[model samples]
Target chain A: MEWETVIGLETHAQLSTRSKIFSGASTAFGAAPNTQACAVDLALPGVLPVMNRGAVERALRFGLAVGATINARSVFARKNYFYPDLPKGYQISQYELPIVAGGSLRIVIGDREKIVHLTRAHLEEDAGKSLHEDFHGMSGIDLNRAGTPLLEIVSEPEMRSAEEAVAYAKALHALVRWIDICDGNMQEGSFRCDANVSVRPLGSDKLGTRCEIKNLNSFRFLERAIDFEVRRQIEVIEDGGHIVLETRLYDPDRDETRSMRSKEEAHDYRYFPDPDLPPLVVSEAWREAVRAALPELPAAMCERFINDYGVSEYDARLLISSRDFASYFEAAAQRLIELNPAQLGNEEEARRNYGLAIAKGMSGLLAAQLNRAELDIAHAPVSAAQFAVLHARMIQEVVTSKSAREILLALWESPQTDESAIDAIIEAKGLKQVGDADELGGIVDGVLAANARQVADYRSGKEKAFNSLVGQVMKATGGKANPKLVQEILKRKLEG
Target chain B: MIPYCADNFASIERMAISLVDVKRVAHLARLEIDPAEAEQACERLRGIFGLIEAMQAVPTDGVEPMAHAQEMALRLRADQVTEADGRELFQAIAPQVEDGLYLVPKVIE
Candidate 1:
């Protein structure tokens, strides 16, 4: 029997709060161990925890971003667990009532769009790091990360394949960073994901016994681990064995997931409302304020990119991968329209091709130039108006593609804020395209006469020989000849 | 637990803490309860549950759960980095410290 893999993700995004979730201690990473753990974070005697307003506001922003219902009143609960990293006997988290509940995210996997429903997102404190190495038969504890605020966003088991799981994880990862809630640094462990995977017979409503795979830091690991786990579950069941519900760990080196804790060692996190913290109440004005503060979300902007700009979904996804890229594309697009709009081509093609044109420039040569200079798109030396003019010049045959790249490199090296800087560079360098029929025809005629072997070869049906003639024409004209005009004149002269 | 029913009250009263239950709870809280201590603990737990039984008799339909006695909203603190490096001061109190990290028994997962 075939099995359908069901996967759900629980992402722990460490909020970028300056202080700990409950204590007025630095939440900065790479602090000396136990240095940033204050009295409250350490859970020392005679200390009470006060929730950070910034943390709550970040959570509210996430709820608004996902279109979730922001609970007016939510309570903190203590999840009792015994671990050396947890200085407190119990972890203070939201349970019974989380701050945000019931939201959905629309993820686009290839051409398929899926709406992954969210279970809930809760506020919780992070556990400290446990370094097992470098201590003989002993473990070392670093409490600097303890008590850091994290918003644990949980999703429903709607994903079917590893590809869809990755798509959902990436969408969530992009979203958290876009909203500026979490840094989304997987390397630094600011963002982490745990997937709950199971497999049941195809077309079955009942969910199979799931094993929670923990601490998949990278998306590649998430996909590989899920694939590994799904296959393992299928094999175990097919071999007349039963699936065990337990927590598992994904080992990237081994490329497999193994049970971290057995069923007998399962934790019964006796969850009860924390007595020290009263109910958290978010007012109507506060929710509206967060909603107003939210920037144009990625999904909505992506839709706008496809609908208004007439760009393909793949190009739209590439642009919307980051806010800086999307904004740069948008600004360049508007500048294109501001320039001679007719140069953008027909109305229908303009809507579809104009954004793609800007996207190509931004992602292609401009992206490479920025990388060479170690500059991001946000800090690019070339202004959007300048880029738009460059793209517009290409459309108008003012400069060939090769000359356009040369101008782009010049502008990149020397910072130019002026919008008309592209034209200045084009004029100063004399890189104008030879669009005149007479000028191009003379160049083509000279090339045809000079290269007798290529011309004779072309006449004798060596099809590639025609390209050599075109190259000679471009070389004769100092490489500023319009390629289309050059090819048109070359074909006309050679055929006649 | 089943709802407080007059017919099931007798069975509920008989459902006192078992030795196994006490042992499990003791292990979770990281406490040692000897067999004799378990017997005494069971008697004491019965008294606590008896009082809870008395309270459960009261009908509480449509009543919201109380998280705290006071109706005050939880106060929120500003996000600021006011704490400095106090590893020496804090690590001084720990029984074992190496390179500013607390040492414990190796916990291999």
Candidate 2:
């Protein structure tokens, strides 16, 4: 029987606020284990939680970005559970009515675009950590993360494959960072994903019982966990066994999932509306305030890159993947346009092709270097103006395309504030293009004297022999000869 | 036709509380209730439920359920960093502590 995989993700994104959601304690990571925990975070008796206005505003900003419905009134409910990390027996979270409702995120699957619909996003306080090692078989608890604000974004089960699930996650990760809501740092546990995966026969209306794979921190792991779970379900069904609904943990070392707890042992949260806190009421004016503060989102910027910048869909997506890269592209493109105003004339085709050239250099060449250096566009060694200068020189035939790569490497090794520094490297390394016709013509004469058999081959209609002769000419000049001028001079002398 | 609702008081009195129910509720709340005292605890809970039953007898038709006794506006605090971290003071009260972490019986990862 054919199988189809179904996936839904729940992501907990830590808000990038200065203080915890309810208390004024610092949310900075890696503080001495419990140093950041305050009375309110530790859930000391008689302490009331004052809602952090910054946390609420960040939620509103995210709602506006995704075009979700912002509920005017939402209630905070107590989710009761017992765990060592939970200082309060009950966690305060939104249950029936969340702040944001019914939005969709666009993810690229292969070459086609697909929308992963979101069920809801709610504001909640994160629990503290349970440190299990270095204690002689006893576990330790760190309450530093106890009151950190988190936006739990839940998605509908619209993803059909592990690949689709990963794409949706990557797009959402980029967006959270782009809007400055969360750092989207998986390493520090700022952003975490839980995937609900199930498998059923193809074209079946009923979804198979799902086992949630929890706390997958990296995208590669999320995909692997889902794929492994899907295969496990198919094998179980094939062996005449029913899948048990449970909560499982993905063991990255073993590359498989193991049952953490079965449904029968799951906690009955005994949810109730908390009496201490009143129902959260958001006014129209407040939503508008947050809307005014939001930056231009990634989807809109991606469309503009395609329409205004005239690049391919793939390249446009790549350029706008990060906010910094999009800004860098705009600055470099503007510089290129200013350097040559003639390209902006009535020839619209030429203008677009010229834009494509600049796009290729920025997205392909510069992006590769940034990835190798493990630096973001914000901290790249080569400034936008310097890159623009190097690109312009290559297009103007001042430096060969091969020399441009060398200059980029040199710039990365010893960076400068000015683009004119490239001129010094070119002169010192003798990479200046020898485009003078008189100088190149003398070298062509020396090549013709050495290879008479190759010259005979070209006269007899062997086109490859002519390329060999051209290679010799470039080799004699130490690859500094202008390729276009070399081709012209070589053709002229060979014919004579 | 005989107005059976008039005898609601008698029906409330007949409602029974069992020791088993008491034990289950205590276990769910993570309390270790002794079996010897389960009967007394059950009787006390029944008294509380009896009062709720009497209140339930009151006709609440056309009345909306209220979450709180009095309607009050929620107070909002400004989003600002106002508290200095007091990590040591908080950790000092834990049962056991090592390297700023609160130690407890080991749990599976």
Candidate 3:
């Protein structure tokens, strides 16, 4: 019998705040270990924890963006655990009440759409790092990462495959970056995911034992880890064995997961409300203010791109994959329409005309030239207006699209050059399409005369000879001949 | 439901978890558990399990299980940088340091 895999993800996004979550300590990365730790970070006696308003505000932004319910009041709880990394015996986290709850993220895997329901997003302080190498075999603690604000977004077990799980993680990653709440840098541990995976019999309603995979910092690792865990669990159950509930670590080098420890139940932590900090309460006005401040989320932006731009779903999705890229496309489209008033005769017409131009030309330029050159849209050598001018020239049949691409690159290299300068460069380079029927006719006639046997083959119904004739004409004209017009004239001449 | 007390707990279940298991778990967690502490922990865990048995008696029909105690949403803030504390505060906690980084004992051979 086949088995079905059920997966859930717990993502930890480190809020891009300037200071640590509970104290006014710097939250910068790559600082000398312990350099960013404050008295509060060390949990020293008499140091009271003060919640960073910036941290709270970032959490609110995520809540608003995901359309999660925002709790007017939430409490911090002490999760009691003893470890070298945790200076404070108890980690300050939300238990009974979280800041956000019950939101869903939609991710597209292949042609199917999967919605992962969010269980909750809570505010927590991160633990420090322990270095085992430097202390002559003794472990040393680095408190630099301690007290960093983390928004742990937990998802319900809704994913059925590793592909869907990764898509969900990536979507959330993009969302955080889009809202500017997190840098979404997995390498620096700015964003990380924990996967809980289990396999149940194909038709079973009950879930089998699940193992929690911890510290999967990359999307590739998350996929590999889950794939390994699912197969392992299936084998274990097939051998008349049971899976032990445990926390596992994925070793990417070995491409395997090993048991970290038996999973801890909540009762093990002996959780209780933290007495040091008061309960957090927010007013309706504050929620509204945060809601109002939310930028267009990826889902809404993608839908709007399709509806307003008249672009295909695939193109719209790609265009809105990143907020920066989406804004760049919008700016280019708006400027192009503005410069050519005929294209902006109405809202619908403006969208169709500009959107088609962007989909065909601007997208290619942005992705192939600007992004490949490691330049942002603002830093691009060619502005939207200049691109519009180039596209307009192409639309008016002054230059072919092929030639326009070359002109775009030339303009991109020299932003200060005007359209006439670009046209002059094209002309000087002999890149203009040979649209002159008379000139193209002469070249076609010479090709037919030079290759009588090939021309006879075409006359006898071998149409492939026609392309060679077109190539010869284009070569003779230095690729300046309009290929479409040449093809029409050649087919008329050859067929007759 | 019987109230929790060390004296009233069942005795056979108390010894079910071997001393070796406790030591192994503690070792894996990198915790130094003395023999006396292990015995004490076993007794406490037994009593805790006795308390848990009382929960099984309460009927849960028509009751929605809650992962969290309250049904509420989290508040969020705008994505703006607003703080300027520096690394001096964290550096003070290191046992040793160099070049603004935490220094640890050498381990590689």
Candidate 4:
């Protein structure tokens, strides 16, 4: 009775280019319904869409980044469809052949890595938006988005579960942002996914009827929609009802999917090569230029982090998930190495320790402070240099790790303050660790005397009682007692 | 223009799709198709299938399947924000708009 879910994703990533793909109109978001619409976007009779060079280059950049075969020559086709939002009767898209093909995305699900093969990525123009009002019985169309550029990245049905599908989608999202081709803003419809899901008996060679779920803008919705659709299909088949192939829309509020329409085949669209535009021929030089312009992608950066920074795969993955975060870590690591040469005895250990500090301390502090301030990493008050200085101070044992964290908060509140100034504030606040063993011993002795019963229990082999004595000693010293020394002294006293 | 054999017609073997099939499909798509139109569409489809007999003569051996007429590359753009302002133009075309968004009818209960 076990059924396996098979999933494929078709993602439309709105290119981050400034202008519309074929028109000179602006591609900026949140414009008046028609203000950004140019004559071409309005589909005026005399107007013609001139391919934007920038949009083309962005597509090539994505192709190179994903290691797809950049088609030397590709053609645009007209997909004829009728909808109020479509200003023109037909939409210009790549159908018969797309720009890039046969690429693979590596995704990590749990501890295992899976490669999701990409079928193709094609360039297309976006349609206008339709508007309907409560009072108005009629609908309106906004042409601002009509000519915007989109790259539809289609994937093979290589995913088996909703988790794997989500993992693949997230990896693609990160890759797009990392390559600087797409903003990958799910909220703004900049990046969207349509999942094609089908379920068959486990290990069945025959494919089952598939349903396409549309308008999954966020990763959370992608996971939920797929999970619901899989179960729905399985139930339909179990009840002796054949699964129907159709397009469905995900209703996030209801947490269910409703049928949109029967799936349309290629013939239904009446696709034909667009006669207006000529074939797009990319020269070898052009492909090379795009390949050279690509920044270090996530995969390369992750490998480099492990090799150059000596970080673990998990830590490197976290750091390289975002380009900005990875850059921040690299900058901070560089500064720490420059400031504290004595702490890092050799080049290898220097990289290793620097990476470990960043993974454990710096990342944690950044996450906590950013969350507290409700700010993104870009708007964080603490600069990379300040973070480096704080880590250097901690490594030098001038302040304990806990004290350094407090100093970091103070620095984040006041970015203009330097490491010395933060250290002065910590000193003024009397937050420095009590490193003197003699001082810690006296505090421990007082704690033992006050909790005689607990101390006796500790002496009688109750380890929990020993921890309580250490807590009292730390409290007696106002949490300034070096915890390592406090624990050593308390254990010695109790055991003795 | 392509001819087809009557024996190769899967629809005839599966079931005779009457006016009922057309009506159901049209209803699912929210199209108001008249009964007369549905009958005409069914007749047209049956007539179209009768012509498939011509395809059996065309040898599709070394003939490569043609998905598109021509093969070409798609042009790309530099990943930069180029467009500046557009709010006013978008608002002008909206039949109805609220604040900054295009208002849509509440489709859900």
Top candidate when judged by DockQ against the true structure = 1
What DockQ results do all the predictions give, each relative to the true complex? 0.55, 0.37, 0.16, 0.18
Candidate 2 chain A: 10-residue stretch with minimal lDDT: A341-350
lDDT of 1 by residue, A427-478 (tens): 9999999999998888788888889999899999999998888888888878
Q: How accurate is candidate 4 locally (lDDT)?
A: 0.78
- Predictions in order: lDDT: 0.88, 0.85, 0.79, 0.78
TM-score quality measure for candidate 4: 0.81
Ranking by lDDT: 1, 2, 3, 4
Task: Tell me the TM-score of model 3.
Answer: 0.81
What is the lDDT for A251 in model 3?
95
Where is model 3 more than 4 Å wrong at Cα? A264-267, A341-347, A362-365, A370-381, A411-430, A439-453, A492-496, B1-109
- The Cα RMSD in angstroms, rounded to one decimal, for candidate 1 relative to the true structure is 3.3
- The lowest-lDDT stretch of 10 consecutive residues in candidate 1 chain B is B1-10
Q: For all the candidates, what are their Cα RMSDs to the real structure? A: 3.3, 4.7, 6.3, 6.2
Look at candidate 2 and tell me the lDDT of residue A105.
Answer: 95
The C-alpha TM-scores of every prediction are 0.92, 0.91, 0.81, 0.81
Q: Count clashing residue pairs per candidate.
A: 0, 0, 34, 35
Worst 10 residues of 4 chain B by lDDT: B1-10
Better of 1 and 4 by DockQ: 1
Please state the CAPRI-style docking class of candidate 2. Answer: acceptable
Candidate 4: residue A36 Cα off by (Å)? 0.8
Which candidate gets the maximum lDDT versus the true structure? 1
